[model samples]
Target: MTQPGFLFTGTPLELTDGEAYHLRKYWKKGRQAHSIQSLAAFDVDVDLDALRTLVQLDCANCHLAHVASCCEGGFPFPPAAELLPVLDEHLDGIAALLPLDVIRHLLRKGLYERHLETAGHRTIGTFDGNCNFCIVEKNGPACMAHRYALQSDLNPMSVKPLSCLLYPLDLIYSEEDGRTLLTALTERTAAFSRWGPDYRLDYLCANVELRENLASADSPNIRENLPPDVFAPDSYRPAYVEGRQLLTELYGAPFYDELHTLIQGGRRP
Candidate 1:
């Protein structure tokens, strides 16, 4: 029930110092002009090929709808107060097309200025009861806020919460150096491919018949792990591109270009 925020965990992260500082500033100030730069490479276990092959994918397939629900506890990233005002100007016609609860939840969430002092510390998400802004009809799922954002000329980053934008991808920070590393909570890298088939990417490579490990490296004490082989193949091209975008957004374009150059001479797994 407690939606503990990844940033609020206060752990020594696997990211670069600059990136971590950028996220920390976000926690301190709701909206900030982030300095998208890297301090060092801490979580770059996989190369550009593996990095490029990962994907965030559609929310319909993502468990985030039923999981996180924007409940980043202790994280100070709040929704912008001016978003609804901007949406109101654009969503007049779009509101009718959405589900009633979606419209109602959006109205309820944006009704007043919610402050941490008045609202108190909430461990769970503020609007997980029905997802605050999800409007599901016969035609599949649609995010009302995203729709309104698209119609309006407003920037979603200025309006929507960062937790929503950075779902699954947790930008963890280091305490001493303020380094930050990006990671997917849903997946994890084994200690040098200790787990059978590099399970961090198992779900993505389900179709491929990967080799099984002698034992699981899930535990810290596990000794024997597989070699860090390039698990990503040609089939995972889409995920690679998606993952690249997330990296680019977080680390800026230059970092991505440098990594891409390194992978150009990379060999197939």
Candidate 2:
């Protein structure tokens, strides 16, 4: 009588038992996030440099900078298998930031081919199973590749790679009848209004209520504020905006403009 997921009329979506299993375990945050769909909103010309500054300002406490203490080092969970070429192109740019030993191991092992065998989408270094590029600092883990790309004059997509550029925002690829579908979704948000307390507490999203609870007409917390003055040093880029940027990077400027126009017209993706 009841559905598997919660939300609107399509609530309790159709699912295989296996799919249901993971959905039960993981969809709290997901179903709530579906309410607004993070990509529905937009913030242009976000000051990524300012975001870097914020991460630096409170490096220890900010959880995003953390290493993979749970697993090996911090495998960036790289792009799909097919995009390996695009991912490899940036290795030269990021190599300078890595240790020689790590570099040597990566080269000796033959980069993607070897790592792909063991780690699947992980960016492993050496035979030790650690991601070659994650620099474990005293505070946590920092990505040399990401740092290099942000600072470099090159196009971030060409040099930065998708995994690093798109962290909190996730891309899901699926196949149904004949074609493939790619969906980008945010992990968590405080904007889950159509659900219950269990959903809000169990769902767990980031930066959702940050906008409402902090930003005001004046003296706003920069990270919580969106649609900020692009020229300002404190402009904060939301995951939604970055998702658009990532899409643009993968496709082109025209795709981003079309997507933006569609979203502005209030059509669902």
Model 2 clashing residue pairs (backbone): 4-12, 5-12, 29-203, 188-205, 189-205
Candidate 1, residues 1-269, lDDT tens digits: the string is 63222232222112233434444454333213221323255333233223333443344322221222221122323333433354345455556656665567657755333445323432112344434445443222245555566566755543444445553344454454555444333222222111123333322232122214424324332223334332223333433345565567656887766645434544322
In the order shown, what is each candidate's alpha-carbon RMSD?
12.0, 10.8
lDDT of 2 by residue, 178-226 (tens): 2111223222211222121232122112233333344332221133332
Assess candidate 1 and give its lDDT: 0.39
Off by over 4 Å in 2: 1-72, 113-123, 126-129, 137-141, 178-238, 261-269
Q: Output the number of the TM-score-best candidate.
A: 2
lDDT of 2: 0.40
lDDT of 2 at 252: 74
Shift of residue 132 alpha carbon in model 2, Å: 0.4
Cα lDDT for residue 92, candidate 1: 54
Task: Return the TM-score for each candidate structure.
Answer: 0.45, 0.50
The list of candidate 1 runs beyond 4 A from truth reads 1-43, 47-53, 59-128, 151-159, 185-240, 262-269
